[model samples]
Target: MNAFEEEREMMLRVQQADFVVVELTLYTDTHPEDAEALGQWREAIKEAAHVRRQYEKRYGPLSLLSVPTEQAIELGWRWNSTPWPWQR
Candidate 1:
């Protein structure tokens, strides 16, 4: 595939993850007895985590909705404490 096609594919995968999260949340809430659905939810969550790590490695950190991107900021704390989005 060309670059455009590759980028489109990546965007589609991202959208799929978003859709999966919504569906899994509703499914798990409504049908608590479905082990398979729960397993799917776990897989979707793992996928989201993997995607997050990939983006953080390639690009900068994606700060929380409450916080802005910290790419332009300096470290304000010790080594034990990272920026807000990355803090443990």
Candidate 2:
């Protein structure tokens, strides 16, 4: 696959992990002391972050918060050329 396709796939993976974490977070709010849920949430968060970093390294930044200094310096206004992560 091309770089764009690969990047989209990685972004999808990260999105899935983040969704799982959010779901687990809501469950933990009710359960409070569910060790298993908490552990799964932590794992999901870690996996999401790792995939995010990988995406950033391979394909520019994913969001304003995760923007790398090099990307800012190198790409400047070119980021607008690409579609947003949530967009088709």
Best by lDDT: 2
Candidate 2 achieves a global lDDT of 0.78
Q: Write the per-residue lDDT of candidate 2 for residues 1-88, one digit (tens) a residue.
A: 9866877798888888889889999999999899999998888889888877877776667777886547667767355776655563
Residue 33 in model 1: lDDT = 96
> Which stretch of 10 consecutive residues in model 1 shows the poorest summed lDDT?
71-80
lDDT (Cα atoms) of all candidates against the true structure? 0.61, 0.78
Best by TM-score: 2
Task: List runs of model 1 lying over 4 Å from the truth.
Answer: 1-11, 65-88
Tell me the tens digit of each residue's lDDT in model 1 across 1-88. Answer: 9755654555566567868988998999999999999999999988976765554433345444312334334432232344433331
Model 2 TM-score, 2 decimals: 0.76
